[model samples]
Structure formats: C-alpha cells, structure tokens
Target: MTIEARFRIDRGSFTLDVSLSIPARGVTSLLGPSGCGKTTLLRAIAGLERCHDGLLKVGGVIWQDGRRFLAPHQRPLGYVFQEVSLFDHLTVVRNLEYGIKRVPKSEHRVSLNRAIELLGIGHLLERAPGTLSGGERQRVAIARAVAVSPRLLLMDEPLAALDPSRKQEILPYIRSLHQELEIPVIFVSHAPDEVARLANHLVLLEAGRVVATGDIQTMLTRLDMPLAHDSDAAAIIEAVVTGHDENYHLTHLDFSGGRMTVTGNAMRTGDRVRLQIAARDVSLTLERQSDTSILNIFPATVDAIIDEGSAQVTVRLLAGDVPLLSRITKKSAAELGLEPGKPVYAQAKSVALLT
Candidate 1:
C-alpha cells in the first residue's frame, strides 16, 4: 500500500476517527470544513500529533502502529504548510540546502538544481526569503521540501495564505509536480474548485470522520454525498475540439453531443480537453431554443428531483444517463412543471475548460 492511516484520537471534546488508504501516486485531497480535523489528521499521519490509536504507513513502510511510532524527523516526508516558514535570516539557497544537507548524499534522489528548477526559483536563490514576494517565498518553501527527496508529500492548504494572483501563479507549478514527480502528495483543502482542479482522488471528511472517498468526478456526482448539493456541483466531461469558427473565435467540443461552443480557449482541432459546467450554469428548457443567444444546448431527461431547501431544487439529469446536475429554484420547477420523464434542453451559461 502507498499510504495507510487509521486514526482515532480524542482530545477533550474533539474526537477524530478516520481510516484511509490512499494510492502512492497522483494527488489525493483531504477535503472538509474548518475544525473538521483535516489538519489534525495530517499531523497524526506525519507523527507530529500523537494519537492513542493509530497505524500510519507510506510505501508499505510502517511509520506508526499502536506499539511503535516514528518521530516526525524520522519519517521521509516533504511538508509544506500555509506559512512560508523559511528562515528569515537565511538566503533561499541555504534554506533549501538546510534539509537537502540533512539527508546523506547517497540518499539524495533529487538534486538541489532539480528542486529549484521544479519550483522555478532559480533567480531567487541568492535573495533572502524576506525579500521575496508571498508566491516566491512559497515556491522556495516547496523547493526546500522537494530537496529532501521525501517518500511522501503532505501539504496543508499551501495556497491559503497567497493572494488570488499569487495562487494562480503557483498553480501551474503544482500541476507540473503532479505530472512529472514520482512522489505521491496528500493535500488538505476546503475549496471545491481547488479539489476539482488539482485532486485525482478525494477523501471527504465531515465531523472528523471519513464520509466519502472516490475519484473527483464520482464524488461530485454521487447523489448520496453532499457534494452533489453544492452550488458549484456539476460534471466533468471530456471533449475534443471538433471545429472552430474563424469569425467568432469560438471553439466547438464534441462529446456525446456533436458540438458545444464555449467562450474562451484557442483550442486547436482535435485537441482533447475537459470541461467543468456548474449545476447552476445549466438551465432546462422543454425544447431547443432558436431565439436565445445560448449556443450549447443538449437533450436531457430528468432522472430525480431533490429538494435542496425551501427555495431550490436539485435535478439529476441524464444525457442518455450521463449524469449531469442542474439547480433550479423550487418555485421555478413548479412553474415549469418539471419531473421524471421530462425531456428538456440543458442550456449552459458558461463552460470552464479544465487544463
């Protein structure tokens, strides 16, 4: 097993009982609300927070058990928290070297240059962490982690501290790590968009318990889970660029439907892509509209009607049973007289291309 962690810890009123086995490769997100024990669970797996009952292992290497527990320093882990937490006095190079030097040369599977290159921090190596921007410092922090050549990487909302612009700047670097690096990463975040974009697998926690775990798409679409009830809840559809309108700068996607035209992206013909359309983005119509500006319309039939609250209803749609969710107000549903066997055209206001 790549990662094996079973935690049952109690501290006063807070109790966290979770058992999870994550794959060794790709990104797996630990998602939950604040104080839901995500950070505590990360700490426990890292051996930073001692648990009365725990069994943690990475790469089939036992790090913690009821009888034996490995210390934090002993575990080959690359940890990057929200704070940059670099040595203010030390130059970026030295900060990276600090951990790289700790592990013997024979054990250094990752080179110092490689870490800097991976983080795109080659220029900032001579500067102090204090002189760097928030994103720059965070990149250095990540470089320092990778320099250790850890068996597993654990990050706790590493982008939480950065501003939106900084987050965008660093997201691609994180993506590269997932695409190129060998080590598996376990990241904790509460943001749905982040999970949707970054995580290949998801471990959803609620009240300090493992509520659900699955691929990102399945977790988002499963009606049994609360994720399906989210305002942003929808589906990821893989599509290919079938054609483009030269005059309008519009690209068409071919999925089950012959075409879908979205606003952005200069997609070349035949380039495969993923699109994210929010449930709220979809508006159901009984027949295809010829008068509207909406370019993308799909034939769908209602599968289930879940009343989300007094005002809103969640409709599970089937484009030939390819599940897509649409959120409409309860009043609107009643006005439209929507129900099972209702054939409608799902109109999307926007479709986000997943890069």
Candidate 2:
C-alpha cells in the first residue's frame, strides 16, 4: 500500500507544486522551515485544502481526483493538530467517545480500551482537559484520534504546544503508537530532534517544493542537503540491544554495520532501538586509537566529502552498508588525506538512544 499525491496550489506570492509516493506504514515526517508548505501539503492530503489539479490516492482509496473529491469527513483519517482542541465541557473519555462515535461499529478496528492503553491515558479518562498537564492532554488527544481506527494518522506538530519536559513526557506514547499500530502516519514538524526521534521516512520541503524524500538515515546524512551541513547534523542508526555490561553501566547495541556501546539504557536484550550520532561528535583517524576513552569505534570507509564552510568539511563514511557522517576541520582532513575508499577509524564521543 502507498500514498500517491500530486498537488498544485497558489496563494498570493507562494506556490506549491509537488508530487511524491509515500509508504503506507510507519511515520513519514514532513519536515521543513516555517511557511515551507508542510502544513499546506498535509491539509491537501487530508482533503481540507482545495488544491488545483490534485491527485491523491491512499492505499486503494482515491481521495481526490479530477472528477471527484472526498470531503474531510469521508476520508478514513484522524488528525491531531498543534492545539489539543479537546471539548471543554466533556471528560477525557467523552472526548474520545466523540471521535470513535463518528465511525460505525462495522468499521471499528481499534478498541477504545486499547487506544487508551496505547497512549497511557487510561488513568486520565475521568479527568477534564483543563485539569490535565500539557503532555497528558496531548496524549489524551492522540488516544482520541486512534479510537476511531483511522486508516491514516495526520499529526501537525502535535508536540509544538508542549514545553521540553512535556515533550519528553509525550514522546514515548507517540513512539509506541508507531510501533503498535498498522496505520500510516504523516507528521509535520520543524524540529529536527522530533523528526530524528520519530520518523522512519522523511520528506524535506523548501519554499513550496519537495527538495528531497527518502529514508531518515539517508536523508539526514546526504552531503548535498542542508541537513548534513548544519551544526546539528547527525546520522540515525537502527540497532538492537544485544547485551549489557553491569560493571561499567553500559549497553551494547548491534546494527548492520557494527556494534557500539552506549551509557546503560532501560531496554532489554533483543529490543530494537534507534541511535543518533551527531557528526560533530565523530572524529576520523587514519588508524584505530588504543589510548582513546571513546567506546564506540568502527572501521569505516570514506564515501564522499563536501565542504561545509571555509574551515570545515563533512565526510560521508560507510560502516558495512550503514552510512555515517563526520565533521572535521579542513586541516585535519588534509593531514589525514581523506578521500573516497580510504579506510579509517571513526570514534564517536556520544550516542543518543531513541526508542
């Protein structure tokens, strides 16, 4: 199953003309700067915007075409906006019931109880939205959306309204939803950290067009893209918890390329996880260093290099099939004679685990 979308819209000085095929499952993040048409594109997919000559096909359903257009209510989707938008007069359960009641019993796939459990909001069911914390309110809002058993979930900066602590509180629930549900999700956000944490697929927008769209790991590390040149540039690595060293308080993660040890995580053995390795934290050496304090070191082959600025260069490297990025000064790169196919040792100073 896939989503094939083609849209063209013009509003005053801004115009959006883009086409792409998105996967039917997992989270696809529509990422870009402000006013880059991320929200506009999502609205087009949700059938809330009237885009000219648009063609939208989700799974096997034709949402919009030349002759026919499905209304927002007709589409089997649940939308979570930046605002909670909960019914002030209703309890959490009632607000959830409001969403599920819109669909007939014959179409119910996700049970209300399961939705509540998934979002970790069962305890807040009897409370009013005003009484709950920001994170709790957002979790409740997410549960309400899932209660309807949507074919697609559209989240437009669902965490934007929350503070850092609130965001941290609600992120796990969002991650669990992606893992447990079969529904496709299109999330819009300007936060790189949020995208790195949640997205398996990425669609990058610039101005009003899609600049790039691909797997998150590849997209983030692509040397040609602006992400690779940014100070926050990093590589997203998918790994599994192989074991833990109780003595050192460290956990071993094994990916397709190699293994790395991170500070002890709460995950159990065989649990799949994602790791974010910032380019700035990685340094390349011609040979493996034995006196280093870094625990995560891998033998990598240089793939390509791109100049970030007058003094720094971003080098793309490959550890087996996995791609990584290293940002170093021009002097270091020149001294090491870094080039494509050169064998080197990559030392990672820090690795962040994202479930």
Candidate 3:
C-alpha cells in the first residue's frame, strides 16, 4: 500500500508545492532544514491544513479530493506533536482512555493493554501527567496515540522538545512501535541520527518541494544528495548477528557485503542489527591487506568518485550489492588511479552497532 499526496499552499513569500507517493509501511521520515515546510506537508496529510488543489489517498482510500474532503476528526490517524499535551487533571491511563473512547469498540486493533506494553508505561498509568518526567510524559502521550489504533501514525519531531538525556531515554520506546505495530508512521525531523536510526523510507524536502525520495540506505549514500556531503556522513548497513567470539568478547555480524567483527558482546546470535560506518573511518586499498589492524576488510568495486575540496575526495564503492562511502585525500586517490568499476579493498577502522 502507498500514500499519495499532492498539495499547494501559498502564504505571502513562502509556497509549499509538492506531490509524493510515500510507502505505507515502516517509518517514512520527512527530512529537511528549518522553514522547509516539513511540518506544513505533514499537516496537509492529516487534514489539518486545507489546500484548494490538494489530493490525498492512503492505501487506495481517498481522504481528500476535489469532490469531497474528510475533516481532521474523520481521518483515522494518530498524531504526536513535539510537546506532550496531556491534560494536567487526567492520569496517564485516563489520557490513554480518552483517546480510546473516540474509536469504536469494534475497530480497536490495538488494545489498551497492548499500547501500555508497547510503550512500557504500565507503572505510570495511575500517576498524573504533572507528576511524570519529560520522557515519561512523552511515553504516555505516545501510548495514548497508539491506543486509538489508527491505520497511520504521524509524529512531528516527538523528541525535539526533550533534552539530550531525555531524548535518549525515550528513543527505545519509539523504536518498539515500529517493531510491534503494523501501523505506518510518518516521522518529521531535521536530526540525521534520528532519521538514520528510525526511518526505513526517506523523503527530502527543499524550499517546500520534494527534492528526493527513496529507501533510507540508498538516499543516504547518494552523492548527488546533501546527505553524503554532510560533516557526519555515513552509510547504513543491515546485518545479522552470525556468532560471537567468547574469548575475544566480540560479536560478528554478516551483511550481503561481508562479515564485520565489532567490539561488543551485547548482541546475541541470530539477531538483526544495523551498522553505521562513517565515511572518514573507511579507507580504500588497491589490494586486500593480510597484515592490518583493521578487522573489517572487504573487496569492493569503485562506483563513483567526487572531489570534496582541493585536498580530499569522496569515493562511492559497492561491496557486493551493499553501498559504502570512503573519504580520502585527493593525492592518495590520484596515486591509486581510482575510478568507476575499479576493484579495490575497503578498510573500516571503526563500526558502530545500532539496533
């Protein structure tokens, strides 16, 4: 299933004109800089912002068109704003119940208990909203939204209001929603780390227009996109835990490209994990080095190369079917004669394991 949206909103100097078909599964992130109309586009999808030439369809069901328009209340969607707007008079469970009461009993796909379990908020159910911490309050807010059992979930920078520590405390609960619920999520954020960790699909907006849209892995590594040139540019790799070295206390993960050994024992065998490899941490070699400190070395074919500045160049490589990025000095690239389809070996100095 897919969500089709077309909207044109003009206000003085700013205009939002976009047409997109977003995947109706997993988390689809709306990523851009500030004042780029990410929130405006999300509001249009939720029926909160009405446009004369707007058309919206979710899973083939028309919500807005020229003939008719569904009001915000009529749409079956749960929205989580940056601020936790729970009623001060209501308890955590009561806030959740308020949302549950709006939905028909017959249409409740997610039970109250399941929502509580998903957010890990069972202990805070009886506590009032004012008594909870920022992270706790956001958890209750999210559980309330899930209790509605809507077909779609829309989050507008749900962690933007929280501090760094509070944001860290609540990210695991948000991650669980993707793993446990079937509802499609539209997440809005400017933070690349959050998008990298949570998003399965990516939609890049620029000056109120859709600049690019694709799977997160492909979009992040594309040289033409702004993501690859960012200071913290990195590649996302999906890998599975193959085994563990008991004596070395290291875990081994395998992807389509090759195997990687990480310095950790937290991940278990047969578990799925995400690996983040920064471009600066990877170096290219003409031949596979047998006597090297880098444990993660794989043969890769150079796909493309772009000069970052006068001193350095960024090289795109394909290890089997997986794509990787490596940043090296221009002099080194020239000496190695790197170009498209050239066989080389990529050495990863460090790898971050994210789950």
Candidate 4:
C-alpha cells in the first residue's frame, strides 16, 4: 500500500507544486524549514486546504480527485498538532473516549485498551490534563489519536511545544508507535534530531518545493542535500546488538558493514539499535592503524568527493554495503590523493545510540 499525492496550490506569490508516492507503513517525515509548505501540504492532504487540481489516494481509498473530495471529518485520519489541545475539564480516559466515539464500533481497528497500553498511558487515565506534565499530556493525545484507529496519523511537530527534557521523554513512545503499529505516519518537523530518531522515510521540502525524498539513512548522508551542509551532519546506521561486555560496560552492535562497540548502551543481546556517526567523527587514513583510541575502524572505498567550501570536502565511502561519510579538509584530500574507488580506512571517533 502507498500514499499517492499530486498537489498544487497557489496563493499570492507562494505556490506548492509537488507529487509524492510514499509507502503506507512506517514513519515518513515531512522535513523542512518554516513556510516551506510542509504544513500546507499536510493540511491539503487532510482536506483542510483544497488544491486547485490534485489526486490523493491513501492505500486503496481515494480521498481526493479532480472534483471529488472528502472533508477532513470524513477522512480516516488522526491529526496531532503542536499543542496538546487536551480538554482541561476532562480526564485522560474522557479525552480518549472522545476519539473512539467518532468512529463506528464496527470500524475500530485499535481498541481503547490497546491504545492505552501502547502509549503507556494507562496510569494517567484518571488524571486531569491540568495536572499532567507536558510529556504526559502529549502521550495521552497520541493515545487518543490511536484510539480512533486511524489508517494515517499526521503529526505537525507534536514535540515542538515541549522542552528538551520533555522531548526526550516522549521520543521513546513515538518510536514505539512506529515499531508496534501498522499505521503510516506523516510527521512534520524542522529538527534534525527528531527526524533522525523517528523517521524511516524522509521527504525534504524547501521553499514549497520537494528537494529530496528517500530512505532516511540514505538521505541524511547525501552530500548534495542541505542536511550534509550542517556541521552536525551524520550518517544513520541500523545494527543489531550481538552481545555485551558487562565488565567494560560496552555493547556490541553489528551492521552490514562491520561491528561497532559503544559504551553505556543499556541494550540486551539481540536487540536492534540505530547508530548516528557524525561525519566529523569519522577520520580517513591511507593505512589501517592498530594503535588508536578509535575502536570502530573498517576498510572503505571512496565513492565520491564533493567540495563543501574552500577549506573542506565531504567524501562519500562504501564500507562493504554500508554507506559512511567523512568530512575532511581540502588540504587532507590533496595530500592523501583521495579519489573514487580508492581503498582507505575509516575511523569513527564517536557514535550516538538511537532506536
């Protein structure tokens, strides 16, 4: 199943003209800066904003066509805005009840009990919204959305209004939703960290245009995209926890390319985890060195080199089948004679765990 969209909307000087056919499962993030039509396009999909002429089909259902259009309330979708928007007078159970009541009992796919358990909000069911923390309120809001059994969940920066601490508390729940549910989620966000943590597919928008769209790991390391321009640019690698060295407080994660060991990974054996390796954390060496503090080193072949500026260059590398990125200076590139197909050793200085 997939979501096919061909949207075009014009208002004054700003215009949104884009077409996308994304998978109907997993989390697909609509990532871009402000006023880039991310929200407008999302609203258009929800029927809150009409397109001049468009085609929108979610899975096997046609929500919009040239003339036929489904109103927002008629569509089987759940929308969670930046604000928690919970009723202060209602308890958590009441809020979730409101959502499940909207859909007919025969059409319910996600049960109220399941939503409560999935979001870990069963403990908060009796608490009023005014007494809950920001993170707890958002968790309830998400549970309410799921209680309606939506086929598609649209989140407009649900973490935008929360503080850093609250965001951290809610991210695990968001990740769980992506892992445990079958619903396809279209999330809007300008934060790279949020996208890196939650998204499987990424749709990058800029100034009302579709800049790029593809797998999250591939898109993040693409040297051509604006994401690579950031100083914090990194590559996301999916790995499985093979074992752990309890004596050293280190866990072993194995990916397609090779194995990596990191400290303070509180994951058990056989668990899956995603590692974020910053381009700057990776250093290239002509020959593999044995004596070094860097534990993750693998043989990689240079794929492409793109100049970031006068002083630095971003080199794309292929380690076995995995893609890794390294940002080095122009001087180092010239001295090392770096070129496509050249064999080199990549040393990862640091790795951040994400799941």
Candidate 2 regions exceeding 4 Å error are none
Per-candidate clashes come to: 0, 0, 0, 0
lDDT of 3: 0.92
Q: What are the models' TM-scores? A: 0.87, 0.97, 0.98, 0.96
Q: Give me candidate 4's TM-score against the actual structure.
A: 0.96
Better by lDDT, candidate 4 or 1: 4
On TM-score, the leading prediction is: 3
Q: What is the lDDT of every predicted structure here?
A: 0.86, 0.92, 0.92, 0.90
Model 4, position 290: C-alpha lDDT score: 94
> What are the runs in model 1 whose C-alpha is more than 4 Å off?
104-109, 238-243, 254-259, 267-274, 318-322, 331-344
Residue-wise C-alpha lDDT for candidate 4, range 1-355, written one tens digit per residue: 9999999999888999899999999999999999999999999998899875789999979999988899899999998878978988889899999979989988898899988998888888899999998889998998888889898999989999999998988888888886787888999999999999999999999988899999998898788898887999988999999998889899998998888999975788898888899999999999998999899998899999999889999998888877888999999999999999999999999999985
State model 1's lDDT: 0.86
Model 3 lDDT tens row, 273-312: 8899999999999988999999999999999999898899
Q: Rank the candidates by TM-score, best first.
A: 3, 2, 4, 1
lDDT of candidate 1 over 178-241, digit per residue (tens):
5777778889999887777788789999889999888776777777889999877977776899
Steric clash pairs (candidate 4): none
Error of 2 at 14 (Å): 1.7
